[model samples]
Each structure stands twice: as structure tokens, then as C-alpha cells.
Target: MKHQKELYKEAMTVLKATSRTFFIPITFLEKELKTTVGTAYLCMRAIDEIEDDEKLPNTIKAELLHATSQLLLKPFDRNAYLKLLEPYRHQLPEVTLRLSDWLALCPEGIRNTVASSTSEMADGMAKWASKGWHIQTKEDLDEYTYYVAGLVGTMLSDIWLWGAGIKTDRELAIGYGRGLQAVNILRNQSEDKERGVQFIPDGWTRNDLFQYAEENLAKADQYNKSISKRSILMFCKIPLALAHKTLDTMRKGNNKMTRKEVEQTVEEITSE
Candidate 1:
């Protein structure tokens, strides 16, 4: 069995590799909270890799996601999960394959909460993948974002309250998550199209998506302002600032922020 400290180190290494905006802020967290957040992120990222695998058939993706969800819903069963994913080992990433380790990394008291949230995300991803990600209407877009991102906000909020006695408005929390996801959808619109996936509703122009992002971001602003703890506030501020800057950059006909631009934004916010 791996020591707790080793698991934390592994989780942080994976987090640093996988995320551009989240790593520094997550690393800034105090040790226990960092482990919990990092573990939850890897757990969700594990299933997310399955959802985004181009080589996997939609049915297979759905099967894997649903099975992962079911597995998470029960106790962590290393043998059952490894057997379920064995055939697709070549197709899956390390993050997906070592999901059991991530789950085990969560501190025991809040492990179930993290597992339940990740399980819900996996189930939602399965539903969309099974339907070929056919987002046709505003409602469809809302539901999809809620599943993929809004739930993340709720989960993080729950973690905050549990770990630090922090309280936040759940609706605003959902907006914060949805806002970040909208920015990603806007930035990745072309990439998603290349993969035959479209997140924007039919007849919706780029401006419509921009407006959607702006509306949610307004809520995210409120969510950020409501956070009083400096450490947590800084953690929230980094991504929200990046998302806002990304939206502005995208609106100016840029694809996304340059690394320098991202660094500048983080520096500006952290210096404030």
C-alpha cells in the first residue's frame, strides 16, 4: 500500500501535468484540502478521458462511463474496476486507469462525497456520449453544462464547507462552474467541431455563446466576492480571472490567451 504522502505527491504530479489553470491554485491549498481537491479532480478527469477518447465507439464510451459510475456508487473495488477496463487499457489514459488510486487518495471522512460527485459526472457524461452529444436546444446546452461543470461547482462548494466551514450560494457556485465551462466550450469550439461535437445550440451564433458565458460569469463574480477567506478567495480568483481574460481574448478574434497573457493575468490577480 502506498503511503498517504506518496499518494498526495503522485496526485499533485498528475494535476500539474493535466491542468494549466488549476494546478497552481490547487497547490496553494493547505495540505489536507489540497489532497481532497486533487483527488476529486483526478477522479473526474479519469472518466472525462473516457468521454473524450476519439477512438472509442460512442457505445463503448457510454458503457465505460456508466460502469465507472456504478463502480463508484459502490465501495471501491480495485479488481472489479480493473477487470472492467482491462480490454480498453490501450485506449485509456493513465488518469483513467488509476481512478482507484485517486479515489483512495481522498481523506476517509469526505471520500464518499467526492465519489458520489464523480459518479454523477460519469453518469452524465455517459448520457451525452450515448446520444452522440447532440446538443440542439438551449435546454440541452444547459443540461449538458450542468452535468459537466455546474456539478463541479457544487461539489467544490461542499468540499469547502466541509473542510473549512466555508459557505457559498449554491446557485452562484453552479454559475461559477458553468461560466468556466462556457469559456472552454468557446475556446474549444473548433476542436470540438473537428471531433464532430457541437456544444452550441442550433441557430446560435458565437455571440449567443458569448452572452451565455457572460451571464454565468456575472454570477461567478458574485460567487468570488462572497468568498472571505484569502486562501480560498485566491484559489477562486485565479480561474475566474483566467476565464474572463480568455473570453475577452476570444472576443478580440484571438484563439485564446498566450501563456504570457495567462501569466500576466494570474500575476495581476495575485498581486491585488
Candidate 2:
């Protein structure tokens, strides 16, 4: 087995490769807190990659997601995951293939919490994948976002309280997650349509989605205000600021922010 330090180093490498938004804030976290949040983020990203794979059939994705959920329900099992993934190793990304390492990176006390959240997300992804990611109502959209993103908020709240010695409202944390996901849906609407997935409800307009994002972002603002730890506060602020900027950019007819704009936003947030 790799040492925890080695696992954390690899996790950070994967994180930087996969998500600049999270990598920025997570890097500033204190040692153990950094490992805990990094572990959770990588684990979630592992399953997310499986859910978003273009080449895999929905049935195969569902099977992999369901099996992953089942594996996470119990204690960590390297052999079981290896056996489960061996058949489609070539089809999956390295993050998904090396899920056992991410899971093992968590400090033991918080490992189960991270695993359980990831399991729930995987189970949710499996359901949506099996259903062809159908979205025809506001409720349906909410459920889907909750599974994929809102639970992320809940998990982070748990981590904040556990590692940072700060507590926050679980509901507001969920709003933070949903708000970010809604912005993503907005920014990716064209790409998603090209891929035959529609996050917009049947009759909803762009304005409606914007409204949804704004409402949740309001809650996210509240969630950020509730954080007392400066590091955790800054951690939450950078993403929230970026999400707001991205949403505004999309409103102004841009697909997404430029790399320069993203860096400026991060700079502004960190400098404050």
C-alpha cells in the first residue's frame, strides 16, 4: 500500500488535473483537513467521470455506478473494487480505476462519511443513467441536482464541522452545491444538447434556470457567511465568487469565462 503522504500527493496531482476551481481552495487547507477534503473531492470526481463517460452505454454506466455504490456501502475493499472494474478497465479513466486509492486517502475517522456520500451520489447517478437522465419537471431537476451536487454540500458541511471546528446549515450547504451545478448546467447547455441530455425542464426558459441558480446562490451566500474559519471561509468564497462570475458571463452570451478571467476572479477573492 502507498503511504498516506504519497496518496495525498497523487490526489492533489489528480485534483489539479481535473478541477482548477477546487484545486485553488483545497490547496490552502491545513494538512489533515486538506487530505480529508481532497479525498472526498477525488472520490466524488471518480464516480462523476464514470457518469459522464461518452463512450460507455447507459446500461454499462448504470452497472458500474450501482456496483460502486454497493462497494462503498461497506468498509473499503480494494480487491472487490479491482475485480469489479477489471472487466472494463480500458473503458474507464485512471481516476475511476484508482478509486481505491482515493478512498484510502481519507483519514480513518472520516473515511466512512466520505464513502457514504460518494455511495449515495453513485446510486443517484446510476438511477439517472438508467432513466436516460430524463428531466421534465422542476422536482425532477431538483432530485437530479441533489444527487449529483447537493449531497456534495452536505458532505462538505460534515467535513467542515469535523476538521475545521466549524458548523454550518446543511440546507444552505446544499444550496451552495445546487447553485454551482445550476451554473454548470447553464454554461454547458449547448454541449449537453449536443450530447442528447437536457437539464432544463420541458417548458423552462433560460430565465427560469437563472432564477433557480440565483435563488440557491442566495442560500449559498448565507452558508458562506456562516463559516467562521478563515481558511474554510476563503475556500467556500472562491468557488461561490467564480460561480457568480460564470453565471453572469453566460448571461452576457459567453459560453464560459476565459482562463484569464478565471484567474482574475480567484485573485480578487484571495486578495480580499
TM-score each candidate: 0.98, 0.98
Candidate 2: clashing pairs of residues: none
Q: Model 1 scores what on Cα lDDT?
A: 0.90
Q: State in Å the error of residue 168, model 2.
A: 0.6
Record all residue pairs in model 1 with backbone atoms less than 3 Å apart, i.e. clashing: none
RMSD of each: 0.9, 0.9
- Candidate 1 residue-wise lDDT, 138-207, digit = tens: 9999899998999889999999999999999999998988999999999999999988998999999999
Q: Which stretch of 10 consecutive residues in model 2 shows the poorest summed lDDT?
A: 3-12
Question: What overall lDDT goes with each candidate model?
Answer: 0.90, 0.91
Model 1 CA lDDT for position 159 = 91
Q: State which candidate has the highest lDDT.
A: 2
